[model samples]
Target chain A: MIHLQNVEKVYQTKTIETVALNNINLEVGKSEFVSVMGPSGCGKSTMLNIMGLLDLPSDGKVMIDGQTFEAYSDKALAQFRNQTLGFIFQSYHLINDLSVIDNVELPLLYRNVNRKERKRLASEALEKVGLGNRMKHFPTQLSGGQKQRVAIARAIVGKPKIILADEPTGNLDSVMGNEVMDILLKLNEIDDTTIVMVTHDETMARKTHRLVRLFDGTQVN
Target chain B: MIRHLFLIIWNQKRRNFGLILEIFFSFLVLFAVLTFIIDKYNYYRQPLGFEYQNVWSIYQDTKGAPKEEVFATQEQIRNALKSFPEIIDFTFTNSNIPYGSSRSITSLKKGDKEIDADIFTVDEHFASTLGMSLSEGRWFNESDRAAGYKPVIINGVFKEEAFGDEPAAGQMVEDYNDNPLKIIGVVDQYKYRGEFVKPFAGFFQRVDTTFAVRSLLLHVRSNADAKFEERLNKRLDQIASNWSFEINYLDEMRKSTLRETKIPMLIFIIISAFLVFNVALGLFGVLWYNINKRKQEIGIRRAMGASKSGIGRQFVGEVLVISTLSLALGTFFAVQFPLLKVFSVQAGVYFLSIVVSAILIYLIAFTCSLYPSVQAAKLQPAVALHDE
Candidate 1:
């Protein structure tokens, strides 16, 4: 479960104040698949970043699973993110120097998992996304769709409670994009993983359990 | 974590090869400089084997005086200064004082074995005049002047090398031509050149019938002042009219011997420090550039739950791993110098240099990586990830 109360994000420079997210309140329940749709510069990514704890809202309270984050230190927030949240980006963002399996093990490494167990879990996660055969391959050697699958494996390797996908299919063709969406739908349906995704496509938005639209940093529908 | 650091470095070895080489050369250069400094420091701590305070050397510039006349004039001067209370003791030698500029070397024979040695020709009182200690037998006396077999004193190094563990007193060593000379005593150390030069095989023989003596050494009583040189010159002029001479304090000459090394040692240290500083700068620049290039990776790690300290540690640990690899390569080459006896330095000096150089490189790499690592840690994950 995730909740944002009166969340506001304002970007201040010497001559201007830009409102990225303003006075918003929202909630996503356990095991729900939600999609946020907006045009460019309409604060969808900012909202996703705030929900992911990648950036703190300028003025608001963030509550996850009924616990507020107002008292969490930076280290505590990092630990919370490692244990409770996962992120999938448009670029895949897999470390190029590491093997596919190594990229999947990155989150567990920060969790102090034993090396043997880390390898075991990373292999299992890679298998879930059908990338077990490509465990030793590098990101540079994979196709865009395969890279996104690897990124998906990495996101789920830690078995976090919530998965946040920001424009996950922005760089893929329709066929590959549909393949990625099928994986996400299966993860939500079978594993009951809470999923929050940001998308520009209305067709993709309609498949989610709920759709939230934004215009100029405010929720419209 | 450290193993992970190693893995990353290994993965990027091609990019890191130049940094490894820079550290390798810096480590080697530091090893050499530390070895030389520690060797000299150890040698400087040893005793110089003779008292140099209040002693002075007078170069007896014969200026083409014939052999017989030079001998006669030396005897007259020795007799003339015998009663001057300011001069405690005086002796004649053939251009070999504690820190003299000239050297004399000759070979001594024993059966089929010929040993090359530094030779000093002195009077019966030379040992007492220089305050040197003898471990066995007596100094040359009037009885030795008769000279059926010439009386000689050999230093401990020469005695050991020529006759290992055998009693040296009363044994006969020979001149290059097989003329026998009895070894009357053994002196422990006689490092006449400087602290930097090791003690060599040496023999001291009495100055009897040879006018080759070119130096007159004196032990003036302590508390003698600047006026002492004036009195000494006056005394010398009264005895031998044609004795052109110059006097210098032996203590000053001894310090100058060390001073000669001190200057070059300082310059060497400064140059080495500058070289290490440059290497540190190079390491810093490389690490900064590398961190900047990996901003996205850094952000990803942070987003995935890496603490700020974790990111910092990763960068520092990576550099430390690289430095350790470089030290391994550098030490492989450095060990050969001592193992093969390449430069005649002490084994302990080289071993200690190896340890110190290893630590120095690790410290340099760690210090140079800290700022860049901190900067990497301070990057905002959202801002960093959004940049792409």
Candidate 2:
């Protein structure tokens, strides 16, 4: 579950003050599947980042599981991020240096899970995503779609409370993108995991149970 | 945890090992040079035959003197020296100051008991002034200097060689070209050669010449100040204006004897410094590269709840792993340093140098890694995510 009240996100460079999100308020209950659709620079990813606790809003309060996170320390933020949310980035952000299993095991490593059990659970997570046979392969050795699957496996390996996909199919072909979307739908439907996906693809956004549209840093009609 | 760090360092050895070895080599060179110089200093510091603390010898640069003072005139010289309280004793000898490293050689035969010996003409005061004492018989006295005194005080080695199992006192030995000389006393060996040079039987005789002695041995009192030397030089200058030589104290000679080795030692030091510099350079570059390459990983780690200093410690731990491995390698080689002597000029202390170098190099790496790791820790994780 996630909640935002009057959230505003701003990016400031030396000579520019760009607003990414302005006075946006939204909530997603547990096990809900939500999609954020926007054109370029519309804060779709920014909203997803705030929901995932990957970035802080310039103004507003964020509450997760009935606890206010707006005042959480950086340490607490990271702890919550590691324990409560899984991220599937558009580029698959799978560590090129690690094997598939090792990449999946990374989140658990930070959780101080025992190494053996971490590997076992990571393997199980990979098996659920149909990447069990490729656990030893590096991200570079895998195709783009396979790499995304590997990243997906990495995300759910620790069994976090929520999964956030930021343009998960942006780098894949339509068929591969559909396959990735199928995987997300299966995770949400079967495991009762909350899913929030950000995408520009209208059809993909339409397939989700609910949609939030943004245009020029503000939610649209 | 340590094992994982080791694995990480191992994986990056290609990027870091050369610098590690370079630093190690530099340290090795420094240690080697320092050890060598210390050993040489010890060798040069060994005691020699004469009194070093309270003895100074004055040499006149005259080719010859007019009818060199006979025994009677030498008495006048002796009486004049007795007037000076600072002059403990005085000797007029053709040559025989320890550490002079100059020598006069001849063979002697006493009824076919042939032997070789160092030959120097000395006066009665030569023994006491130079802190030499009579070991058996009497030294050359004013009475023994009567133009034909054949008394000889053979050095200790002559006694050993001429009478290996027999006593040498009162024995008769004749110089190949001079009259038979009577063995009076046996003097202790004062090496003119290096400490490592073995002793040999040598001849010693007092030659009566018509020419004046080229040098005078002045055994000054201890605690003599600098003014005393100036005063002594002034007095000697009054004796002969044309006689422009030097007054050399035994201690000064001993110190100067090491002067020749100083430049070589300095060269060794420069070479060692050069090595150390390069080693530090190599280590610095490697650590810099490692920090930059691992920037994103460090970002991810920070994002995962690791503190800034925690990530810094991770890199430091990685550097230490590489350093420890290099030190281990260096130590193994260092243990063979003594054995390396057979094939090396700087062999004896090779191992000592290797270990010293290894520690020094690793320390340099650690210091070099600190700043970069700190920079890495301060890197914003949000900023890194945007960096691809």
Which number leads on lDDT? Answer: 1
Question: Which segments of model 2 are wrong by more than 4 Å?
Answer: A66-76, B17-27, B30-55, B59-83, B89-245, B250-286, B339-355
Question: Which lDDT value does model 2 have at A213?
Answer: 88
The sequence of per-residue lDDT tens digits that candidate 1 reaches over residues B88-138 is 898988887889888889999877788899998888878888899988888
To one decimal place, how large is model 2's interface RMSD in Å?
2.5
Candidate 1 lDDT tens digits, A1-221? 99989999999999999999988899999999999998899999999999988898999888887778889888998999999999999999989988899999999999999999999999999999998899999999999999999999999999998999998888999999988999999999998999999998777778899998888999887
Give chain A TM for each model in order. Answer: 0.98, 0.96
For residues B228-344, could you state the per-residue lDDT of candidate 2 as single tens digits? 877766765565555575778777776675455676888988887777677666667777786777776775665445556667787888877777876776666656656655433
DockQ-based class of model 2? acceptable
- Deviation from truth (RMSD, Å), model 1: 2.2
How far residue B353's Cα lies from its native spot in candidate 1, in Å, is 1.2
